[model samples]
Target: MNKVLFFAHLRDAVGEESLEVEAGGKTVAELKAELAGKYDLPRLETVMTAINEEFAANDEVIQDGDVIAFIPPVSGG
Candidate 1:
């Protein structure tokens, strides 16, 4: 299973901070697409994704057992 993390508004939107699923080693875009479909998160387009703490492109493939984090832009004091 692949481990995925979430932060800020993204977590609140989904009402779940994290999730794990058995998926293939597809690109980040593929993963995002699947998740978006499942969660119905229309704002996913505005969110940023990372793998192993490194900002990554949508086409970046996610390896098995990877730690992928979803972080939305945050504005605060």
Candidate 2:
């Protein structure tokens, strides 16, 4: 299972700070689509994903046991 981390508003929306998923062999975007269906995340388009510490495109393939993070841009610096 691959591990996923959610930060800020994403964590609240997903109802967890982190979770595990069988996301290997899938593009980040595909995985997001799956999760959107599973979690009923209708606003998923507003979120950003990261592989390791770098921003990742939806088409970017995720590695087995990769560190994936879901972060939503928060206003107010």
Candidate 3:
């Protein structure tokens, strides 16, 4: 299982700071699509993804025990 973390509005969307998923062998984009559909999340294409605290590309493959975090775009004046 992989630990998926949500930030900002993404966290609110998931209603939790983090959740575990059976994501090993899946790409970041694949997981994002699954979560978006499952949770009805929005604008996931614009969200940044991080694996094990380091920024990752959509094609990056997830591994068992990896920690994934999805962070939405932040705007401020």
Per-residue C-alpha lDDT of model 1 across residues 22-70, encoded as one tens digit per residue: 6558988888988888887768888889888889899888888888898
Q: Kindly list the per-residue Cα lDDT of model 2 for residues 1-77, writing each as its tens digit.
A: 88999877667778998889988899999999988888776577888899887899989999898989887876766
* C-alpha lDDT score of every prediction, in listed order: 0.83, 0.85, 0.94
Model 1 spans > 4 angstroms off: none
The candidate maximizing lDDT is 3
lDDT of 3 by residue, 1-77 (tens): 99999988999888999998999999999999999999999899899999999999999999999999997886868
Worst 10 residues of 2 by lDDT: 35-44
Relative to the true structure, candidate 3 reaches a TM of 0.93
lDDT of 2 at 69: 89
Q: Which is the winner by TM-score between candidate 2 and candidate 3? A: 3
The best-first sequence of candidates by TM-score reads 3, 2, 1
The total number of steric clashes, by the backbone 3 Å criterion, in model 1 comes to 0
- The residue-level lDDT of candidate 1 at 25 comes to 81
- Judged by whole-model lDDT over C-alpha atoms, candidate 3 comes out at 0.94
Model 1: colliding residue pairs: none
